[model samples]
Target: MSETVRIDSWLWATRFFKTRSLAKAAIEGGKVQIDGSKAKPSKNVQPGQTIAITKGTEHFEVIVEGLSSKRGPASVAQTLYQETEQSRSRREQSSEQRKLARAAAAAPDHKPSKKERRDIQRFKRDNLE
Candidate 1:
């Protein structure tokens, strides 16, 4: 058998996605690329190749370091690739932003009355539309 594997399989086996279908969806959505080119779920992947994947505001650049046909523990899965420094920095920044957002949301100490709460809900619904 060939040492290379399907892109979707590799993504799942390496724990980039929760399932094969999700990995396929990411690939089809252009969120995953190989060597800077958008890749398909059926694309063949080999060891030592680089892949870029974007999830929300986070981008990951990983170089394939090993091959596996099965899903494994996080530690084992992590050994399959090496993430680039840029990717790490981006992840840290995204995390910090999320933390700040959470802190801001929880910072308000005043509790709203029932009427105030209803008005706030109405405002949110109106703004959403």
Candidate 2:
């Protein structure tokens, strides 16, 4: 409820990161940007400013709507920022691509059977010879 709040504190309060320390780490690692430029964890966040956050393969762009330094419930936290439509669509596309890639790269739950291994070895041996 202060006039200004630190970026990391706001991020944690908004539920972007599980802990303030993790938020600080991400900020230090250049994973969070404020108004299109890298920002420090201690940087102040004001309402109406835009922030870009990269968490793993997902990217979120949000405009600050409110500021709070204490963590709140999910519903309350979500109200802290407004996500742009473009950013939402991009995140959906990225998630779909990641799902497809993971499906394609999936291996069997169990190792290959002895017969299958033998066949593979035979094929390799024949090709090498």
Candidate 3:
């Protein structure tokens, strides 16, 4: 609970990342930003500052509420930042879209015919060699 903490350390402590190394990698990869700009792992974060993070297909924007450099329980980690309403809604909408897309991409109701199956096997065999 020291006042001075690196952005990567805070990110790991707050449960945003499972490890400090992951947090640092994210920062270096430009997946994490502070106040709308890319942030370095060595940067210091304080209350009232905005942070944006991209992890896989999800995006999060949060305002810092407190600081902690030690990982803690989920409840305590949640208190370290407050997610914005817009960010929440956008995440939900994107998830819903992905669900719809996945549903539309469902496998065919019937299995391939014997000749079609042979073609599929041939394609795989040719490509996987």
Candidate 4:
């Protein structure tokens, strides 16, 4: 409801993180930036400010739209920021790449038996030698 909110609180309120501590960690870990520079958890976020956040393999760039110190529902949280078109496209591309990679590395239906494990180990040992 105020004109500005702390970055960590804003991130949590926007649902970018599950809790304020996580948001603070991300900010401190250099995973969150404002404009083009690193940001601290205490940074104040105002409308129209750009924020870049990296979470694991995903990246997001958003423009702040509203401010709220309290965590809200997804619908309300979404209204807090607008994701950049380029960021959305890049995120989708990366997501597709991850899906493809996962499909290619499909897990076996069953675990290897003792003999199979030994054979695999033996093959590796032979190759190493």
Estimated TM-score per prediction? 0.82, 0.84, 0.85, 0.92
Better of 2 and 4 by lDDT: 2
lDDT of 4 by residue, 11-51 (tens): 99999999899999999999999999999988999999999
In order, the Cα lDDT scores of the candidates are: 0.92, 0.96, 0.95, 0.95
Q: Is candidate 1 or candidate 3 better by TM-score?
A: 3
The collision pairs in model 1 are none
Q: Which parts of model 4 have CA positions greater than 4 angstroms off?
A: none
Residue 112 shift from truth in candidate 1, angstroms: 2.1
The residue pairs found clashing in candidate 4 are none
- Better candidate by TM-score, 1 or 4: 4
Which lDDT tens digits does candidate 3 get at residues 1-129? 647678999999999899999999999999999999999999999898999999999999999999999999999999999999999999999999999999999989898999999999999999999
Q: Residue 17 of model 1: what lDDT? A: 90
Candidate 1 structure quality by residue, lDDT tens digits, 42-125: 899998899999877778999999988699999999999999998899899989999999988875667899999999999999
| Model 1: how far residue 84 lies from native, Å | 0.5
The backbone clash count of each candidate, in order, is 0, 0, 0, 0
* Model 3 regions lying over 4 Å from their true place: 110-113, 119-129
Give the Å error, residue 117, model 2. Answer: 3.6
Give candidate 2's error at residue 50 in angstroms.
0.3
- Candidate 1's C-alpha runs over 4 A off are 115-129
